[model samples]
Target: MKKIFICFALCLLAAFFKPASAQFSTNENIKDQPKWGLAGQKYVEYYYLPDIDTYYYVPGKQFIYQSGGYWTFSSRLSKANRSYDLRGGNKVVINEPGAYRYFAEHKSKYGSSSSNVAVQKSQTDKNIKRQDSEKTSG
Candidate 1:
């Protein structure tokens, strides 16, 4: 009985004790990110496009936008937004789940006209440049 109990405990520990690297690995999550996602980031769940007030779900590859006071999901943006440059526009990395639920908050924080938007864009740009330099130097 003692040996059996000890074996069971050992098995439980082995199952729950994941390696540190494995626990922190973002490779699997990063695979779902969009092509224009931020470089050197571990993983991103959504990209909030402040300029257009839209959220792009990375895993689902869907755009979440407002239409007639309702949240809509589509693979592409509406005709009105067709002229927007998604790749060139400022993108705020949002890791929160169901980010659209806080649309009002996001808008106030990262909206096109918000002062925070410029600061965030500049910070993001600096990080990207730093990462690029590190990659090249290494």
Candidate 2:
């Protein structure tokens, strides 16, 4: 009886985890690199910078922008964007390989969704928590 119950439990657990395992397998081609994603996520193909209207392609480690009526892909931002600060800006992850090609059509859709507020709010929350903790510890 105990062995039968164990077998049933195992089957139930496998059933519950099967979908999750399969889902991860489908994304095996996507890489999980620290330098590629926002919020410290492991895998992301592109980063849409709404503030500056630019796209950062994570896979190639390049930034894509419009120049002379054509899309330019370069490792560094163009002269006009040299002053743009990446550390403080918000980033939206694009997982598709062809994400850059579709930039012209989807830039506005993703750009409008600002991640700055979330980043700022998180920073503020962290500061408040640190202050509270310091007050109690000291």
Candidate 3:
């Protein structure tokens, strides 16, 4: 009976910690994102390329660009935009799945701001803060 009770307690403990472990992993994923993606974002559905006026669907790994007045989705950029470097362009992470549908209205909205640089600065600040806290605590 004591062994069964101990086993039950261990099972309860594992169940309680499972969700916390998953949450921690999700946070790590967000912190390790690429430059083309938002610095601290997970599950980015799309990346809006303001310079070339194109959208990169993250989940599908496809590029959404306007071709001949119609939206064309492809795994690679069209021949015309092949020269446009993906890394050099400013990208906005859109978490919504159908974010491209409203691109026409919001395209100019993000164009006016230099948010890419701002996000990088914010991420740096977070790292500094975390280091300072750890130093003081430890």
lDDT accuracy of residue 36 in candidate 3: 52
Ranking by lDDT: 1, 3, 2
Off by over 4 Å in 3: 1-35, 115-138
**C-alpha lDDT of residue 36 in model 1:** 61
lDDT of each: 0.69, 0.59, 0.62
lDDT (tens digit, per residue) of candidate 3 on 26-68: 4234433444564445445677777778887766778898899
For every candidate, C-alpha RMSD to the true structure in Å? 8.2, 12.2, 10.4
Segments in model 1 whose C-alpha atoms lie over 4 Å from true places: 1-28, 113-138
RMSD, candidate 1, Å: 8.2
lDDT digits (tens) for residues 1-138 of candidate 1: 999999999999999997666546443466777776566566667788888998889889999999999999999986689788776666777666688998898788667542112112232334432121111111
lDDT, candidate 2, 26-109, per-residue tens: 433245433423453445566777667777776677888889978888888889988876766656555556566777655665
lDDT of 3 at 82: 90
TM-score of 2: 0.55
Q: Which stretches of candidate 2 lie over 4 Å from their true place?
A: 1-37, 116-138
